[model samples]
Target: MKKILSLFLGVSLLCSSCNDVLDVEDISNYNPELVWNDANLANAYMANLYPMFGNWNTGADAFSQQLAGINFYADRITITNGEFKLWNYGRIRLINQAIVDVNKGRLPDAVKANITAQALFMRAYTYFEMVRYHGGVPYITVPQDRYEDDLAVPRNSTAECFDLIIKDVDQAIAGLPKKIATTSADFGKIDANFALAFKAKVLLWKASPQFNPSRPFNNAYWAQAYEANKKAYDDLKAQGYGLVDDYSNVALVERGKESVFTVINSYPNKVANWDNGVRPGSESRGPASAVPTWEFIKEYPMKDGKMFNDPSGKYYKSEEALLQSFWKDRDPRFAKSIVWNGKVYEVSGKAGKRQYTALGVAHELDDFGVNPKAGVNSTNLDRYTGFFILKNSLLKLAQAEVQQYDVDFVVMRFAEVMLNYAEAANETGKMAEALDILKQIRKRAGIEPGADGNYGITANTTAAMRETILAERNVELAFEGHRFWDLRRLRMLDRLDGTTKHGVEAIAVQANGQDMPIGEAREKANRYELVESDFRYSLLQVPRSGVKVNVVPGKYYFFPIQRDILDRNKNLEQNKDWGGSFDPTLP
Candidate 1:
């Protein structure tokens, strides 16, 4: 299948003489009938839709850091009136055109069903993106053959847009196969499982606080979301979907059973640079981009299922103690997801040895030996936080380089489905079901159950369980590009306001005369110690000093539609609080 798709990519869209013939009074343009007639061509066209999946590593992940309180604000991120607009109609046009062609094509019912299902899925997916960003956009299903009334369709209501998304997904689910066989030619194709999972996610968003905010919380919406999530969870589980036993290798292992939907990339064709960009400065080929902030790092729970910062717990009194115990015996996911100070990582081409040095610390030659200076000035190219993301960093090789390996980027996995179910279930008063799911996830993470066989979650009340589920999601899905959207949908961005991002500061202390050529008898002496460890936590200044950053719920929840789009379409309305007049030019 890959080889066939590659062949299509290499071919020209039209013959060399076709353009010349058209210039000689042949004004009629060519239709994409060949693409619809051939299954391979249709499949190739569908492949183009895969790239539409978000590249979180490069784009939104960085922007999301502020909202998630995961990183110190390096620069103030301005919220503009044109943050994201429904300006790009190219994908929509192609999807609509494909749907039209697929319905009219002379293919077998089975073949046509799969192709049409995929086209509808893409269309729904695109519209979902638009609605999430800008509340209501014009729901145009049919391809615009000519300009006239079709070109100036008015904007639909937010509920109308969501209804259309659900409708399209339902059609896709009915037509798509339950499962794609491993031996089939189209192994990684979208199936009913993907559609169902997506439908649940959309419904969950619709029920979230940002979208369905009423004076009194709407329990009915939550119930609806709960039912949808439950159906998706049960159906996906029956189809053999479950979490990977080892969370560390989730990204390393491609298209495993845990993955329900993922963007598969292969070497030479498409490759992810996450490993190169997220590895620590000392180990990475280039400057690391996604540094894990102290705010995020401190969120991981202890091995005993207690918050690391709990006042009644065994909290680290000093900075030295914090760094010493921070990575030691904490949540298993912590070590699997982050590389902190003193965490030794394997390097290729030599016998790997455990080593520790604060990021950007300089090594200096001394009488005792080469000593690492903890207070040495470092560049931003070095990690701003003392930690780096370890989940996507494939550093087990002899020498890990940028863009060398093709790691599949997960979009939706079984673990996320479980988390969604747990949240919705709890909201709808299904406490026992939610707790069971939470216990399963916690057990997989190596968290021990309490005396009562619970995962130390004594909170059976809805409010407490809600808090528990949110925290679990935070740790379980950290750095997977879910934090920002999660915060936004919950209308909880204010939680990050007035918070300071932090990192660890430490100096390496070496034993006296350690660098000297010691006799065999003296070789057993202590070598070094990390001393005077301190937490470097500080409030970030935005738009100059003394201005605390805050996300206004009314204005900032939904992004504004671009000015040019409003100009082009007379019926379109700009989002409120954006300070724009909707003076549309009538045709």
Candidate 2:
């Protein structure tokens, strides 16, 4: 089967296992031999292929860092030198190689289609991440030959890259199976809703303030974003995808219906860990990345669905009293996302108490023994901060020796689709539609769905709905890796700076066997204090190693291209005015 397919495709096909560079003895001599001869070989190869996505060394482990509070610059621990370029180039090579083999018709039609969809989806995904990080990158779709002139490809325009992503997603949606059959082992193929949701995502980013080239907010882009999001929400809802009845259980249950698409991380099938983004209770929680900021924790509106500063609400008080009252009425997601000190969360041992601390002076978990811990100059207090994220941490796994459990990595969810719809509608002046969607999500969360979803707010004006929807998204999707991009896409990065913010508050627990004093002890006991003046820098400067920075005032739009590539491809020009400069200046 593999042989015939190879002959037909006119090239060899090797799956993840066979193509692994780690196992290759002679890298230059690598070639597909048995890959075409066996069905199991093809299956194994395909299955192993996605490891790169999760390979901390390769793909961003997209979910972990994005969901956690880690920033890209200064908080640059997530990205490394040559890291971004390598993964993009490597994955493109894999997809290009597979496309060459599959086009030969040696494989079964189903196999060909499945592989094509996967390749297309991956290529699109690779480009999506690339654009998000680098603004735009060389759109390399095929494997370059030794003498190929495309090796020194210039960076494509961001608009062009977005167009390519839309095209690829469209093709994948058209060619892929509407649904993968239960008997089919070839799971994870791109589906209708997944592709649609992604299309909406791309459109939303494009329509957002940061990338919305149609400045002053283009009506067409807004409408397009709204239409795409609406279709995705409607389609998914029709397919039985809805919010989890009880919002608290959304992440607690693995792969819930609310999750439209997720990077399936099941135990036994794939023995992987996501602790590097988690906290101390788990083996990988060193460096303490993603520590929830006191500001973020305070964003959840009171459970009564009122702002913390509402003059009429019980939450209005001194910062201390305000937080105490605030914590009581906020959405349930707050507790699920943050691990306050003394709040019993799942830990390694049955009776073991997971003590969250700051500086690790009294807490061992805070000391990861690495440079700067989470990042250079990151507050040493961050090392022993008061809270840890519990949203995706597996409670049951706390008891097992390995603590193996399935933590679904949701790529697209019904709730997000709804939120996207609400955002687009509100942006496009469709206030009624926007209000309906926001209310639906709030209803599921067991909130009154009125503060933002009320008739007065919804019926007043489009701008009114806009703020409500954006705030609703923040509270609902807090810490799910959506904030950074959401802020950027919304073009509200700078705007978010002035908003009330919070971070993990640290208090001395113990030092050399001396218990913390009463004032500090009680302060630590509450675990709901707000951090003062939370916003530092909201945007990052494009590093000079890649391309000269030519960003415009009022926006941080510059992205670096490979300097060497520019040397080779003189035709390529850097972003306007940013080709040669060094200053993390505001856009």
Candidate 3:
């Protein structure tokens, strides 16, 4: 396993030829005999597939605004066909080559089955990525050994591609291990549960409104999705997989009980310095690129499980009162996931001391002398949304050692599986089962269950339960990169269009004492006055220069196929609403 770590510790360590997999040339240097005969070599080849996993920490794609809901005005959506539109056949070719060689290898049946199953999983995973992003794609299973052979390949229908994906996953499940130890030796490898979980997710997406936009929702698709999620939930629970006791630490633990699948990492080999992007300026030298939006902050329910925006609730009397009490007596997840004003945080190597994001304290003395908002500005990298992401901050690292924090990114977890099952169950009229699952998640989040043993969810009708499940998913999975996709699949992206994102404005109270304290002390001394702003809309202004942020419903749903790809492959079709001279059918 250590050797496996060495082979896949960094993206640089992967075979250089991997990027050239799509190239139509002689790659006999990477012949099956050279890799498949040796187990270590075979494992190394499989390791290259890890990079293809989705970026979970940042909802990084044209569709998503930066994590903290800051930079709402940035050109988050692609206006035209971009690089991602260009089909990169490299990974598929690599998987095809692996499958080809694994079949020809002389390894023992058990060993060969494991390796082959892994290759199959990669193949299915790759195809799923393609279909999700580009609709139907060319379903190339066999390795293209020659340039002439590669040219003959044609695109397959979306349904056909999904069918192949399912077949590959089903076969992989048949051959993969049911479970493996969380120890370093087996922590990152795919298993039967991983396949099941992924399959359930795939089915749910297939049934989503984005995929099936017909007038009457597809009940059959929803039924299939429900069954798949139920099977995954039951089997995973049987295998001792369940939610971690604390929701805050779920991402911190490596291959914990909650993680069904994760992108494995090891220090120095595959280190992940998430702090480089999300850590506050006061904590690290890295840029604070993703800041939470006021929209996101308002999503969390009150401690009593009531919606924060409920008019009848005494959540706040005024904007100023809300700003002062927002971080106090709220959901336990708030403190663990967000860095707000007046919060005391520790800085590594700064022994017996703490850092505070108090307003009026000059965190950075600009040329204009002491700036009042410097403390919050420095911590927020000047984005000034009045909040920093703490969920995946990796703040334990010192300023100088920000790059060495290595924590595996959980791709799929039991909590999500339960949510998926609950949503599917609710859609299929299994209300009791749905509520039971929600209760378990809310209970783990420190929310008190009601007399009915449910998570105080009074919504018994399907329509009401649907909204509840979506809101719960938003908070529970915040900053883990599911919001954009969830909204897209639910056909709810229109909800964000023209919406303004807001934040609090904190002004520190200046004192006239000789030994005036700073940081947490200043906060405790009531030396800061927090003001809530009325113009908290995301579309109010552009946070990033030279970019327009707008979500055009019809055209923005699917990214356009690249023009170059259309020219290269005449058979390929452009997505709907993306006007181009390209035709869907070849003459």
Candidate 4:
């Protein structure tokens, strides 16, 4: 800002001989009125607004889906930690100011329409995030003057909030461009089809048990979700958007095909931090966060679409027996998403090296009482959940280049919309359509379709199919930030109560009480793996500050507004769950 001011003053000094000083305008300052007067300036203003949406790491791994996390899952989330607070009226004010200025601007009709649509979409997205956390917030459409305007505004009803969100999204759909191709310059920007998909997700939340707990199985709500999701699916399907064949490439490489909405990223610019955060420290030279829990590891079905506990499945056995060959013959996605004992993994600049996680290995150690200087989980004891995440790791990058990973953060994808449609359709008595969608998803995941081509899915009733859809979502959207919010919106956090999440510690033991030549794991893969005689396994109960499992409260569905926020606005009523009269569940 100082540089811009100096340049402006310099230009004024140069033009003093030709013009009057009183007529020169200070353009570098905050000028909302001047922004909408030109098309390119309006675009630059829109660019400034995109950073508020954040990245793909918010809900990626948490207690609702994975075993634990550093913040949201390490312990119970109380009302005051600000974990549940997303008070975004500041963002709403900016967006509303843009909307008002764009409508009043004298720019080209096309430019005005495009900018207005983008602003409306962002506003709707912000409101949806707030509603999901704290139900209805004050629906402020126009910017409130700091000193002149009356600032005491009450919260809107949940129904009124939804109506306003729908209106904004409808305008966005009407004015935004169609789906832009990967080759287009505007590929990552939100398009008409992506707006439609966002609307579908918003309606899905509206129909969920979080909002409709009293009328838990309302067909009207489900119908709304079904219709919107179907429209999005159809519109995007016609625009050449669908699932990419390889699961790893969907979020990493195929930007325009599977990704319905993407937060644009590139190297040396705004780069994605997902790979650096999840990959092992030994491999990526970053923290080994987001390691999978034992329970989460069991969540993946076998290659035949059967749980490992299914008696009829090929590898079904006792717990110890199952852990013996845990890394073998599972779903193709298992190897893609997780790195276990003695498994070959892709690392840049290395020639086919298998990862060893058992104790006594040179690097990988989550074992008790042993320390190594450069192992994967050696330094951070909390990160050693006995398994490391391998979902979106770059297949070819040297350790030094890990910081340069530039995969776009996929906020919404076609596969998620398909899941939304399936859930809504099944709830609204369109069972056949729902099952078909699920089958298509499983097919893309490389699950074996049985002789009848049903993909080993035997959920013949609505209740059963609903469970199946939820389970599929657990794996399909694993590290993409959908798990906790999914369970919250569905009112299924009770699933975590009374449940214990365990970890595994793999120790390298000497067979027959003598050292064996278990050299490289890949060469000795058949004999010296986790299930062999050279290793000992232990079930670990990892706790943070002596707290074992998650004990989420029921009122957590609608969190309380912070005391500071309530103190500022005298008209604001607090949520009843947090000791006030505003019941977030009331429709």
Candidate 5:
């Protein structure tokens, strides 16, 4: 492969002819001097830069999907192919070059600031993605050049990796324009709100069960975790970011109010559009690239702010009753996050008229194949039966499908910051205060708080508090792709691994000549149909075919440079696990 280093490696290499209009001929080849001199070239480059974070083939979108439990397999397991290896190195190359270019001083101050902040945010995000999957990675800051001597660095300690992440994000926050106050071309630059929200994410993950100092139960880490989350909550609030007053609109109409930051998508620039990425029904998110698990659906609590398993409640009657109770008067997010049999989604119907129907855009055969089976999980191969996702998804009621939804795939949202604050407060012994914050989020969602003020949580102890926080995290961020990571980080992957039955009684009733509610029947049909045994192995390990396995517990925390990466640099050392590791207690 040709080694291309355009932006950050050197400023003098950019061609001077590039201008602000999106009209550069021979755009494939990079001549930074020209591109950097023209504000439009700089803007175009920046525009392309942010969406890079949203692509499923790259960035956090890919990582978050894996972490969130929406795996390609039935449960949490991940399958491997050569494309996986290529994906890792390719991302590193693309991001490094973008960062280098933005740092060069040829663009306007505002343009330069926005691009630099975005690049930093992306870089930090990329690092987090790596650590969560492969553990500590070699901290590569500069682009690789023939003359560079530092190509073979070993894995940085997770803590060291986090420190570097903090620095990049801090710089991003300092340089990025304030999102709430900014407008026009600079409308969505990375800012204090985004930076702080991201920091909370990193810190919260680190403070989680899997990454905290303790392997499974690290109570001590709670204080530090809480502090990290609290910082984000306090800072974003000071900056005017908050929950959308109406709960339902938060996921549908007023996404910006709660999102700390996102890759903003628009029409015509459909290349930058997530339209194809998350489309539901027969054509979109339902077709199988990403599928929702029955267990994941079961994780949602009942309307009275209690788990369906609560022994004292009516929700515990049976799987069918439990599922029905879970969605009953609980929260508005249920409608926004889930697609049931009869739920109406906006789509273009056959008559050229827009219509709302439980089935979206009627199922039809296309390139992929048939629609998803009623109980069968969708994959890249299968299409949606009729249901589709509406949250953060753009749809139309016409054949000329134009995407008008502006809700950015908020990489970070203020609502998340608030949850972080509540979780942290609970850990730090500010239980009442934590409960208050939790209540505010619930109130915004039109649900009353739990008796403990944290979603009907009765446990005041730290352990119970943590569990409540995790549950709350799932509901607030469901379908946005937070559950998988939150579970893994909390070391609750095993709990989420097994199959769960939902709406059993409803299924019986449907069979016994009774017309059951759509939600109940859908739950029964979809829930009992799943066989979940693979979630435990979902977090992928680097393939043994590509490199020797050296990842031991402490040493095995990151991906080793591919042997190809090593062939080029004799100075680099591999991560501990790739070459030799025989710890008997692998989780």
Candidate 6:
């Protein structure tokens, strides 16, 4: 169904999520007393405060080099870089003011409760973002007056920050409805399920090594995460959220079955630029571009759920041989999410239009035509890497229709919730449970279940399970902005040190010189391009030859508070790892 409205729409018909400031319509001109007393006006006020939640573009993925950009070639992230600093006291104060005023509003008790609950949820969300970047921000629940209130508030401890987050989430859950259907008017609005899943995610981060480096695994923190995620998983499952059978169709529908929470999107009014980022500028109407890096391509497994180079996987071959067939026989998601050379990509409302990325590999004018253009103009998209992220692209959209791309951007989905639950379960010695979730996810991705029905999952031990879960998360949640945080939470940024991620740069040749078979790429090439064979692959580093990926600073786990923010707040201490007295990690 085409969702007519999102959370902003659910709150008030006149409200638009496009505007994320409280005073969008100069609400300051209206009497605060009258606005709060009126239900519709109060709802509109809160609607403006809801931060558009989904990472609609290449955001956190850039930090992990999953999406190509300058970040992919960066040497390291320093405290001075301030790559992750979210000190939004202004928004926090707004939420606090909303919570305070909504309570005093003369609306009915239920109406007052709903608005207050939503405000609290937003507050939790804002704080979560803050803590994720700069751990232990001031945990202020009430709006502070600049002139009267103590302006020098010290940063709260990590424990206190999370305590308040969970406390607010619990209260929000109590006031919100259990489940709001994606088809309902309140489709994108925060509900009990949304809050619960968010709580689980928050707890998962809290339990991670980012906060508790002392206890690596099997700690009280993981147990807390287990309970919250299990509750979320059970509650969400009972309410009918699961993996959409076909991966290709998952993001096509607005607030589809697997989505636990998504920001409501409608073209013109509130458009997501996801299409513009995925589609190259050649076929796209917008200039934004983000393609999968070589790291992400290798991260995906073979069709039966094994790495291309895995010794026990379906395909074990040399680096050259593997990258040659990299476009073929992979996790079914590879087909759903990648657009490589000679791949048939739908655009201009037509099927069988080939995307020729390799040099000299020009596509036929149309599938029925034998003639080739003078040059490889169709391949001009020449995506940064050898491929483009086809994840959630609107396949049938004509080039002009890209501006109308309004697919609901999923924030938290059942797949991620399951991953969260599985991680917690594995850390708590529930390997079987964790493995089961992985299997289900693989099944949904169309991985073939072998005779033993293992789906090529080989991890058995807890540590191995941890590795597999994190690896699975990379592929299952690629480009959704999860990888960088996952690496940080696991305290594994060291893995990126001196790492040279690879990308394929293909060039067409007269005869196939490569040893490996091109697999299904030939079939796709035959259907969409003038040349179907004799392509040679070049293994190129994603970055320039000498650029190093050194992430040595421990302070990077919790980004430092911005220098300006520190200059403004005299009492707020910097994190200990950042050469200050306060500790961001939990006690």
**lDDT winner among the candidates?**
6
Q: Which 10 successive residues of model 6 have the least lDDT summed? A: 363-372
Compute the lDDT for candidate 3: 0.66
Candidates 2 and 5 compared by lDDT, better number: 2
Local distance difference test scores for all models? 0.64, 0.55, 0.66, 0.73, 0.51, 0.74
* Alpha-carbon shift of residue 542 in model 3 (angstroms): 6.3
Candidate 1: list runs displaced more than 4 Å. 15-30, 55-60, 64-82, 146-149, 311-324, 349-351, 359-376, 381-383, 397-400, 510-554, 580-587
Candidate 1 residue lDDT tens string, 2-31 = 554474452236334433211213312434
TM-score attained by model 5? 0.70
Return the candidate ranking by lDDT, descending: 6, 4, 3, 1, 2, 5
Higher-lDDT candidate among 1 and 6? 6
Alpha-carbon runs more than 4 Å astray in model 5:
1-32, 55-118, 147-150, 180-182, 213-225, 271-291, 314-316, 323-330, 343-390, 393-396, 399-407, 449-455, 496-587
lDDT of 3 by residue, 25-142 (tens): 5364465665677777677777767677744444442244424343333344453536345365777778788777787887778878988898899889878877777667788888
Error at 546, model 6, angstroms:
9.4
Per-residue alpha-carbon lDDT of model 5 for 487-548, expressed as tens digits?
Answer: 55655545433322111111222444453454453453333321111001111121112321
Each prediction's TM-score against the native? 0.84, 0.75, 0.86, 0.89, 0.70, 0.89
Off by over 4 Å in 6: 1-30, 70-82, 286-288, 362-383, 511-527, 530-533, 543-552
Candidate 3, which segments miss by more than 4 Å at Cα? 7-26, 54-80, 83-86, 150-152, 311-320, 349-362, 365-382, 451-453, 510-549, 580-587
Better of 5 and 6 by lDDT: 6
Q: Candidate 3 at residue 33, lDDT?
A: 69
Query: What lDDT tens digits, residue by residue, belong to model 4 across residues 101-148?
Result: 788878899888888898899999999888888988888888677667
State the lDDT at 189 in candidate 2.
41
For model 2, the run of ten residues with the poorest summed lDDT: 535-544
Better of 5 and 6 by TM-score: 6
Model 2 lDDT per residue over 233-304, tens place: 888778777888876666557556786665565555543454445555334434445555455555666655
Which ten residues in a row are the worst by lDDT in model 3? 531-540
